[model samples]
Target: MKKIFICFALCLLAAFFKPASAQFSTNENIKDQPKWGLAGQKYVEYYYLPDIDTYYYVPGKQFIYQSGGYWTFSSRLSKANRSYDLRGGNKVVINEPGAYRYFAEHKSKYGSSSSNVAVQKSQTDKNIKRQDSEKTSG
Candidate 1:
């Protein structure tokens, strides 16, 4: 009886985890690199910078922008964007390989969704928590 119950439990657990395992397998081609994603996520193909209207392609480690009526892909931002600060800006992850090609059509859709507020709010929350903790510890 105990062995039968164990077998049933195992089957139930496998059933519950099967979908999750399969889902991860489908994304095996996507890489999980620290330098590629926002919020410290492991895998992301592109980063849409709404503030500056630019796209950062994570896979190639390049930034894509419009120049002379054509899309330019370069490792560094163009002269006009040299002053743009990446550390403080918000980033939206694009997982598709062809994400850059579709930039012209989807830039506005993703750009409008600002991640700055979330980043700022998180920073503020962290500061408040640190202050509270310091007050109690000291």
Candidate 2:
């Protein structure tokens, strides 16, 4: 009876601190995943354990991913390399896959901070006049 009591106590202790896989047994597929993005609360939590890779929602904290360190915004690149679109909310993607520090930079080439939609209208008036001249000559 004493041996049984001791065994039960040890089992309970192990259950409390064991990893997620040991704690739960389910038929879930979680390997060879591509991109991990934000869910509900905040930024995507890209982390690694012993043998596999996993991701979850962890806001106010950040992690960096290392495998394919670069997240692409260019359409010319392969689809798999694409980064998360940040135009919606305060969004970001880990260029690497571990823990990373982020810096905010704009994609706009215009001198002043202006709406990207207005870029077309801001075309150096020189270009517009050149186009008009070409049309008149032809």
Candidate 3:
């Protein structure tokens, strides 16, 4: 009876799993990386500002398979956030694209010395606007 139960549990687990072939793919050698974003959680799909480099904690999901250059797994995708790991780190299991960089200057400028992740500011970044306003109005 115990053996039968174990077999049944194993079969259930197998049934729940989605084969990697039908799911996602990995571009481990992807030449480009994804752009970076603010501290907010989400994939920053914008023009990458190369001047200021940053290493954003890429959000990821509980992916288990691969299909067509994307990770595939039988899990509901997180809407607002790109999926995050259990420990709340980058969920992008694969660094297919840069997606993020380390902004040393921004860190120093903002007086943020967190060694965990870096962030960049665009030439037209909001902070730049604020500075411009301060310059003109002041």
RMSD of each: 12.2, 20.4, 18.1
Which model, 2 or 3, shows the larger TM-score?
2
Evaluate all candidate structures by whole-model CA lDDT and list the values in order.
0.59, 0.28, 0.32
Estimate, for each residue in 80-109, the C-alpha lDDT of model 2 and write its tens digit: 323533222123222222222222221222
Backbone clashes, each candidate: 0, 9, 25
Model 1 score (lDDT): 0.59
Tell me how far candidate 3 lies from the true structure as C-alpha RMSD in angstroms: 18.1
Task: Assess every candidate by TM-score.
Answer: 0.55, 0.19, 0.18
Q: Indicate the residue-level lDDT of 93 in model 1.
A: 59
Question: By lDDT, who's the top model here?
Answer: 1
- Model 3, span 1-138: residue lDDT tens: 999999999999999998668456552322232322223323232221222221232333222332464534324323423443223222212122333232233334432322223223344345322111111110
Higher-lDDT candidate of 2 and 3: 3
What TM-score does prediction 2 earn?
A: 0.19
* Candidate 1 residue-wise lDDT, 9-120, digit = tens: 9999888784434434443324543342345344556677766777777667788888997888888888998887676665655555656677765566546654432121
